[model samples]
Target: MKRIAIVLAAMLVTAAVPVGAVTAQQSSAESSAYAGTHVSFDASENAVTNYTVDGETVLQSVSTSSQANAGIGLDIALSAVTDIDASALSLGTTTETSATVQADSGATLNAHDNPKGTLVIAAGDESQYVTANLSGESKAEQVDDSRVVVENDNRTGTFIVVGDGEVTVNEEGNVSADLAEDSRLVFRSYDGERTAEDERSEELIANGSAAAEVYVMQENGSTVADTVTYDEQTTVETTSDAKDNVTMTIDRSVHEGTIVMTTVSEEALAATDNLSVTVDGEAAVEAESYSELQSAANGGDNSAYLVQETSADAESNVYVAVNHFSEREVSMTNDDSSTTDSTTADDETTSSSTNAPGFGIGVSVVALAGAALFARRRA
Candidate 1:
């Protein structure tokens, strides 16, 4: 039964893969190719602890489900030009939410579209993502702990992360995103942009030029082991033994801002210039043990502590942007079991930071581990 719960928990993200209206891409020579308001998007489901609804879609001049969609994890990625008015976004609830949004250049992410008085769209405990367009000479803004962006494509912008999450940016990933308290932000440009022309040699290749940039501002939270972990422990009465722990990775309830930026000049996937802004309240995790650890005596009673260590230590901003993504790969590695798991793990600590100019929309694998052990045996 416990194992069943773990499986369910892993799948709790109901992840509704948004089935976008499919359309083919146009040639670079086509002026209309990859035009206005193109922004990548994603959403998740049902776990909201609180909420609020708004006016009808077109009523507020926005798209409306008019209905309710169950299930949880919703992931929508727009690979082409869009006409979505960000302000027109009608969020059905304003309570506890965990949805996120991402976008590349050529895609208009007009933040001002969703005004409090205009429509009924607001999400709490959620995150946002955007890619800036350097050509349009515009910028994205957000205030969170995790953010990253680059302008190697030749654009300037600002981002703000006022949440408890962390932010990071790469080289050529130009940005003006800033970080706040417990939250962290990073900006580094070491790679060049990936251009569509570069992929001309490949019949199936889309955009070829690659850059890295991420822009984010975070507030706070803890992301740690949400599953089982068997670690070797040093014993005094015995030689050694495996220890179980209650662990999970958590981040500020407010996960806001963009994570990828590309240039529209190359391929639809390579656009930059995303503006975002977010302010989330403090969030915390109640240390819990994974069902798998039941094999240990009194394992259920053990508390947890976050074991964090960075190259720059003591929780400072660390940027890893690259003009040439082909050059670097800065990230976190963990125990074999955790590190080998998935992208969520590789990003034990994450920010809105992203790959520069190319804005490849790299995914972050965050897994914050909260570990704690008591010096007592099962009674």
Candidate 2:
């Protein structure tokens, strides 16, 4: 299911972008920060110590748009980060810790669970690691030339330095994290950061140790966008062996990150535990689709209508459309659209707003465990 969604998203992106063809905008994007930076795994195989002793070094500035110098453990070092982007990453496991990560003065390293035992991240003179399902202390430190490392010698470890942005993790899910704002990142449990030691926090969210968390980090005055429609159909199925509180959280801090769009949901089998799909600590965008996105109906048709726009006053706008239905109807459409002019938190629930708890979409379903497993395989 996760792979399918990824393919679907890629197809949509390809459709939106001409293949092997570059317009002035596309050509400019190549020189833009979020061009195309990939994660590298080779450094994960070259595990070593001295990272803790020397520590990850941060330099002055780096330009991701010019070089697109991306890969795990690129031995990078920089002071100011202008334009950069990433897809997905993770570190180590419970037993054999490792990582695929990046570290910079101003970058978000979104790491996820990597059962492969090692993940290495390097950005702007810093190198780090990521791990999954580990059970011991690992080491992290920076060396000269902005090189850092997480020694997965006796246990698992993950490392990185995240600037202001959002990181996400989900307990039960198959997804292609969507980053639709500048410098914003969407990641799984493997996401982490290496700050200057002033801003620090850590969390591991998932159903079991085998799972991973997701992340979405954004820099100030940045925007990251993905193909996620605010209101869309989604399906989540867990295997028979899946258990415990399955939850996901989008964590944001210090940096003024913003989330301006989102409108997809699956009412059946949504995220267990509390779910925060977006966390913007600073600025933000409007919900790109229907605020009240209704994607699934009675396990039948999965469809949603979306409208995108911004208010005139530069204020945020939330376009709401609920999914009300009559079972007798064959072809259906949204009966109404509820628009909220000014939303208040006290009179309502906490939103996926400015690092608040993630707003929930869809619903949670609890059935027999065996059946759930079957559903996952089918999904």
Question: Per-residue lDDT for 229 in model 2?
Answer: 12
lDDT of each prediction vs. the true structure?
Answer: 0.19, 0.23
lDDT of 1 by residue, 297-362 (tens): 122222111121222112211111111111122221112322233433232223232122332112
Writing each residue's lDDT as its tens digit, candidate 2 over 21-112 gives 54556544432121011222211212211222112211111112112333422442232221234223222221111122333332233222
Best by TM-score: 2
RMSD values for the candidates in order, in angstroms, are 26.4, 24.4
Q: After superposition, how far is residue 257 of candidate 2 from its true place, in Å?
A: 4.6
Q: Which 10 consecutive positions of candidate 2 have the poorest summed lDDT?
A: 203-212
